[model samples]
Target: MADASNFIWYELMTGDPAGAARFYGAVVGWTIADTGEQTAGGVDYRMIGRSDGGNAGGVLALNAEMIAGGARPIWIGYLHVADVDAAVEAIKADGGAVQMPAMDIPVGRIAMVTDPQGAPFYVMDPIPPEGGGESDVFSVTEAQRVRWNELATSDPEAAIAFYKKHFGWGQEGEMDMSPLGAYRFLQRGEVMIGAVMPLMEGYPVPVWNFYIGVDDIDRARDAVTANGGTITSEPMEIPGGEYAMNAIDPQGAPVGFVGPRK
Candidate 1:
């Protein structure tokens, strides 16, 4: 079984799925395939498949109802839990709002939620694989895969408290950005999956940003700009001799990319 608080899935909710497919394919070298699957509400969903034959994430088209209700293109992560109902209850008790009630799906039960500072994400109890094989969904060390998750929120300390209450995350380490305060790294067990920090001034509500891995940061950054995506930040080096950038895809969904310069 996977760890209680590990992020097991990533998804994109976009206004234009086809446009997103083309842009991400160029930027991240992904092959977007039609899963021929629908949500419990019957909306069309697409799959983001990695080159290594492992599934990376999912994409679903925003429908009329969602658009009318002010839905926009965005990427969200799904945190796996052992029990959907209990997780939802704990989330509410810890100052989170349930955007979607717990419900059954083909693969698992899921509930959409927002933390106290309003960072939205999914909590799911996935159905175990048949014949007992592990699902290789995430790989921080693999190129062309989701390598990191980040939460830029209004209050990192309070957000950490709420998450710890429900998901059992602990503060593993932190980086001091004097002007911006601290970048706190969070871990579920031994694996360092992501970090949380204060949302920069003038940014909208709290949101999670996922970093997809690439073989070469420079090449991928160029691909992003060449493919109609806007590079919000130029490539910058991190602790592991890797570089990363933040960007907004053509459809306006924000995403990040990480890897080396070569």
Candidate 2:
């Protein structure tokens, strides 16, 4: 069922929104649109966007209140769920914490969740897109496995269970990743979604990194650093020698880009 609907919108919320807009414009090829803030619970929100001319996502101002409440800066993925209320309850029952209670958005309903650990992911039952990726019972999902989400969780077993109960996601298998660490690719039937790793061991808070597929790895690596992104792990040759690298976007969200090794 995984399709464009499962992950239609993504947002990068950073302290410096202007610098972020410019950096991403160069990296992901997305245009930005700044619409003045609209108040929510007395909070002013500045709107940022790709405006359909670039990629399909936006940039939002980080919530100081949440940060003060022990929230860290990160790029959050809001997956589309069929029923928000039922899904939230199921999550709590399965040991996942509902960091932010379910709230209504103009687009649909959204709720933030932590997988036993504190890494937060957003879930929204979209209003349905006119076309593109949408999850179904038998449809092959993630039209572009080009970009996927990665969750650095404490327990791979429990993580798999939690998602299986909530969204029917399953672990396809573990492929050797060598020096970087073990890689257990995840999927929802045929739809390629994300990866599970041990990056945030024992922190009580998990780290979820997004991966962007580029036609050329070297060019993407250059694009990242050129746009002010930090390369935590430079592109290295995998054992059999394929090319891949890790970097943090201007907002400090870790993402990876991969392609054939030269």
Candidate 3:
């Protein structure tokens, strides 16, 4: 059992699988390929490969029925847990809601859940491969990999408490954002994985924003526009002197990128 209850995998749920594959492939420099596997309902699934030849995540093609049932284009991260069912029960007890009940898949047991603030993510108990190894889907400085996992919620205090209780997370420190609120950094063990901040007025609801690392910020910005994506936020210098920006893909999924300006 993977005892580390941190983000291990990510998946993008999009209506147009092929188009999304192309869009992200160009923007993030990821190699997207068909897994040749389909869900029982025939929805296609593709693997997102990083430049390092490791698995970054996956792209799940949402079918018509899924879309009609309220599924939208979004990127959801999966947190590895010791037991999926137990995590689900504990989450529910703490005011979280289960979007999809725990179920067994070829790789492991997984369940979709939403925090009290309505931010959705997944919990998984993975069946390790022949040689047990950890996932490197997230990295703070690697290009073509997830660099950060940020949560924008209506209630940051409650959100912090919930994650800390469930995942053994901690608030290391915070940066004052003035009128917006404090940006509290989330620490899993000793690594600063991400942060949580109060959701601003413009956002309709709470959501998790994953920022993918790139080699060049300017090149990425150009690719996003050229590939039919909209830049919601222009690239700005972050505390670490790196640049980060938010954007919406052609398929309407929110995404972010971080890197140097070169």
Tell me the TM-score of each prediction against the true structure.
0.95, 0.79, 0.96
In Å, residue 2's CA in model 1 sits off its true spot by 12
Best of the candidates, lDDT: 3
lDDT of 1 by residue, 1-262 (tens): 2344778888899978888888888888888864437766898898888887878889988988998988889998898889988888878887889998999999999999989899999999889878766456667798867888889999998998887777888787899988998999988677888899888853588999989988899999889989899999889999989999999999999899999888
- Model 1, position 240: C-alpha lDDT score: 87
Order of the predicted models by lDDT, top scorer first: 3, 1, 2
Worst 10 residues of 3 by lDDT: 34-43
Residues 132-197 of candidate 2 have per-residue lDDT tens digits of 555221112211123666778767667766766666677777866566467887886666766787
Stretches of model 1 off by over 4 angstroms after superposition: 1-3, 34-36
lDDT of 3 by residue, 1-262 (tens): 2233789999999988778878988888888874537866476888888877899999998888888999999999999888899999999998999999999888899999999989999999899977888888999889888999999999999999999888988897999999898999998888899999999864689999999999999999999999999999999999889999999999999999999987
Q: In terms of TM-score, which candidate is strongest?
A: 3
By TM-score rank, best first, the candidates go 3, 1, 2
Give the Cα lDDT of each candidate: 0.86, 0.64, 0.90
